[model samples]
Target: MVLPPLRRLLRTAAWLLLFAALGALGLLLVRAFEARGKPDLMPWHRIVLAQELSADTLDARSTWADVLAREQQVFDDLHAQLAAAAVPGEFRYERGSRIGARAGERDGNRSFESMPAEPRGGVLLLHGLTDSPYSMHALATIYERAGFAVIAPRLPGHGTVPAALLDVRWQDWSAVVRIAMRELRARVGADAPIHIVGYSTGGALALDYALDALDDARLPAPQQVVLVSPMIGLRPFASLSRWLPLYGRFDYFEKSNWIDILPEFNPYKYNSFPANGALQSYLLTARLRGRIATRAAGGNLARLPPLLAFQSVLDSTVSSADVVHALFDRLPANGSELVLVDVNRASLLAPMLRSAAAGQIDVLRGTKPRAYRLDIIGNLRADTLDVGEQRYDPGSRVPVERPLRLAFPSDVYSLSHVALPFPCDDPLYGTTPRADEDYGIRLGTLVLRGERGALQVSAEQLQRLTCNPFFTYLEERVDAVLR
Candidate 1:
């Protein structure tokens, strides 16, 4: 009897060992297949490779001007190497409307300053990760024209090149936000109310900074906050993203460092995304969540400013559920509001969409007597494409719905995370571009019809809506609050 039991135990151990070995083999094979060729080097990659990677770190810069100069050098180096190799539509260092690199021309990426002698108020805008100040241009322009002294600082790793993302950390980004805010506050004294507008990842930093101000008295406090598709919570993939850099440590898997190493096509945004970007975002969001929780528990939540956030319900980058549950739920009734954009119902994919998506309207706004306002922009009649706003007022029991006179185009199914900040007439990402200025290629209007796998970019990326049809309504809503 003893011998029989021992044999069974031995057999179970052998099977477990076999399964573990198979799992290891499968993971190695997946890694090997992920990045087949030696990926093309970005401009900053080539320059940084020539020296210690620390040379690319942004912590050394003492002033924003120093930041601009270092960025210019990177662009100058990129131009020298790839100007001849670049095509007209592609983003070349010399020709691309690079945020801060036009040494002789208007550099949109450089820190912008529009200050009046007697400013009504002040606004500091922070662009998203891997994005330059141009991402914040339309919003910045709107606030500047509204008599607010506007200052938009280009985040260190950004506004220069894609490879700059390789060595930076979340702490570096938070440090820059502090610097930019101090500069803005100095320009507009204590009597002026200040606002911080963060788009995407910048949203995480803005929230983190505001939480820090609650305890650390040195930090400047914003009168209110505005976030666009804020990275309040990221995908579960982020926890795995940090492991990618470790996998890339081996000579066999260096290409794993990048999530999507693609052609630099868009002028304002980096086409290529790095694993480190995801890693830092994870850290920032985790940190922000913890601080918010701590504040809520200590009864310190009253210090937070009124926040206005705009998010696409179907964001590929962040968890929309977290926006409602994590950030907005913890607030202490300070007039915060969340504006949610629903997907287009007219698209054929609407049927295929998970039923839970439409349910988010009710799910995000639990029972009334809630502190925050929830606004859902979608089609009231499921079969029709006409867009309308369903506003659930704070502390009210019933939701009020109204028609906005805006309708989704037949081909457009949803607004993407990057689409909310851009208007339909935006020169770069617009559907019906105003064409006030040319950026050589019109990315917004590209309607390519071809066989699958023939194009350089994935069909899904091309199919994603790049501009918002109801941007006018968004602007009006924002202006109403500011006025």
Candidate 2:
């Protein structure tokens, strides 16, 4: 007997899906084999730091002192492991080296706290994934000088070794956030306001914490939320990262565990990224999307504190549109604001930019009315390098333009996701690194000219904007809020 047309169509569709899945799997396997040619795995990549808190051991009731003691143990253990391996002097894990993770009194790799003689309030600074508390150190100092006690915690699976990222879960990071908040609250008391400044992955955690606070009164809610290049969503293909690392299936595919196993040259941040790190970030974003939708649907978001977020119009790692549509769009009209840094329209390289990159600001500022204030930092005129702000208040299409003292550097074309939190005078990733401060390498100021594919680092990595030229303006805006 002949099958019905509907049944035949369903059968054909299933077979097509199966073929697509197999094709994708085959491509992944081919890529896995290609990854074998990468640089040999060092001790930092293969040796997972044993002292970093596992998900099962992390406790919400843990105090700030407890966290620091645990971190010290982690460092001690890391040093012991590396000393035994006798890692090369050039490596970051080499003990007593200037570029090593534990170099000075104020080691950026470790969690730290700063307080004034008498604190007015407290602020918790959260760094991004694969980043140490060092990323937040500058901002933390700024906040502390502004009279707020600052606590910057080293999240689990970071600031130790790249191998630590392989075993980390998103929940472990979230637990650290809760514990840090508890200590921050205790320091400032219930009466003084609490605030959070989260960069990249930390931005997602900040938002997640606020959403949780809405439902649970036991958690202290932040008075204000500030985000810098937040990870609202990533590329769709990132979800497939979970399955790419099948190293356990065969010893031959050990290198497949890592997405990019680069030299650990950056003192504070891990250069090597594991497949599991991407998987955890994807899982966190997935959970965040669900929580955001649920809170918005239940009309519970209005209870959340006002949010101020900074986003670059052109970012390769995270989706900029999702920052607006996913989180900002769902936010209540409680004085939330989004500051978008547009590409340097007046740069000489304007002719080289893709049409999509040039028109990204216009696309982000779509026709729909927004509940939050939208500010675009861009060229004041098509011919001028001087920058200005075009402020669009809630529910308004027309903007009030104000001239800013800032001007885009002639050579710089745009800001990057990692550039927002750093100043032009930063020691590590700055255009004009400070004479007094040094991190052994100045990544932001390097200018190299050579044939493509001649260097271990890609041309794209070298060319990507590493420091924010307008960081002074960013600092002023943040100070205004905290003060």
Candidate 3:
């Protein structure tokens, strides 16, 4: 009887334990699903419409007024969602306004401008693949404040719906840049200088514009170029497509380990880009990179403009090495300058960092600045390892050893890829600084205070109030250049 009782008790305990374990696992799975399945605030529809407008392919019946109305609807929907989620208030806007728009008589192209024009020439801002002109807004604002007129054009197949991005070709993006450049020239006058600035895939397009198409007498060439974390190469583990031998397909892959590690700075974190769209982007980048490299090597130095490329040492999506190699190494001797901005730990710890990397933060630090003069043909060697592997290694550090030498004869300039977009605090709706706490307001108040302002808050005081990694990097770069 005692033995039977003991066996029954033991059996019951095991069943209970198993049930508890299963319940815990179920809860975990639910949490994971929730995290992965959160509805994107920026839906695919908006991106597609924006892209259509950029490409000039949308039906004539689809006017900017229609597009703006749809965008308003999308914004309202997103605002409700963000509000419910307790996002910041300053970050929310019902309609994004255009700072300037001009109708030109030449091509009859109407150029829409978003940022104020600065005397330091103009910058054409291009957003990343599967992203809208929204991504460039913050950066454009920064450039505007820095005294550069910013033109952030909606790429083909973006700013409407996600599906449209699938139909867009690399040429579509290139075409928009070309048009935007012409518009910039027309707006600023034919002799005025201009620079092209691109984020992610847009960076590649900027280079392609400078190297391939801008040389024609009809188009004005860029004086300087700024690339922000340019996407030169995709993750190596992406599958190869059967239809396209060279294309890397990432359709089924959602949430890679690298993305999980970084902070989420991107507003479109919830969006899912199509696999084919990604593949197309990869193919285009690869092709353009090759072409620029060839042009740089042939001593055709006059064809390319001075370039500035910035890459996050810890960026998960794009290969920094390929970008440096293609643009920095292939340029003409004494024609281009490359600035590498290493994202330090303090900078990577921002709330948005988690979106870009997995939960863990990787800080990139460099001791000595490497300079390259004229040796464009010398092969630039970069460690072709996954950024994750490098981060995980206890002793490994960000590799900035390879000097960017120009092999071709072009006036190409490359800067540290990440600093082109001056960083700012991205507060969702309710969380941004209060009206009284606004930086601009505070600055104005300080100016009014005069003696008190000098005693209490200096220029540095205002800068510290912004307190962002991107801003810090900008201050440093500006100081270095001025010095």
Best by lDDT: 2
Ranking by lDDT: 2, 1, 3
Total backbone clashes of candidate 1, pairs 3 or more residues apart or in separate chains: 2
- Which has the higher lDDT value, candidate number 2 or candidate number 3? 2
How well is each residue in 1-483 modelled by candidate 3, as lDDT tens digits? 569889999999999999997886666445444434433333222333331433455332444344445435544554464344453332111123111111231110122364354355677888777666655655566556666666776665554334455456877677667766766666666665687878888887887787755467766788776666777776663333212211212322222111112211223321344545666677877788677656656777555665555554445567766666555655654435444433332322333444444221222222222332211111132221111111111122333333332221111111223324534343311113234222212211222233444432234322222212334443344333222
Which tens-of-lDDT digit does each residue in 1-483 have in candidate 2?
657998899999999999999998888888789878878888888886777875578766677687788889998998788889875566577655567433354778888888777889999999999999989977887788878989998999998899999889999889889989998898888899999989999999999998888879989899999999998899897898898886435768888888888877788899899999999999999899888988888888888899989999999988998898889888889999999999998999998999999999988999888899999999999899999999999999899999999999999899998999988888888888887777777788888887888877777987788888888878887887886
- Taking all chains together, the TM-score of candidate 3 against the true structure is 0.53
TM-score of 2: 0.95
Q: Scored by Cα lDDT, where does model 3 land? A: 0.47
What is the alpha-carbon RMSD of candidate 1 to the true structure?
Answer: 4.5
Task: Arrange candidates by TM-score, descending.
Answer: 2, 1, 3
Per-residue lDDT of candidate 1, residues 379-409 (tens digit): 8678888989888877776879999888887
Tell how far residue 333 is off in model 3, in angstroms: 2.8
* Model 2 poorest ten-residue lDDT run: 96-105
lDDT of each structure? 0.77, 0.87, 0.47
Model 1, position 361: C-alpha lDDT score: 60
**Against the true structure, what is each candidate's TM-score?**
0.86, 0.95, 0.53
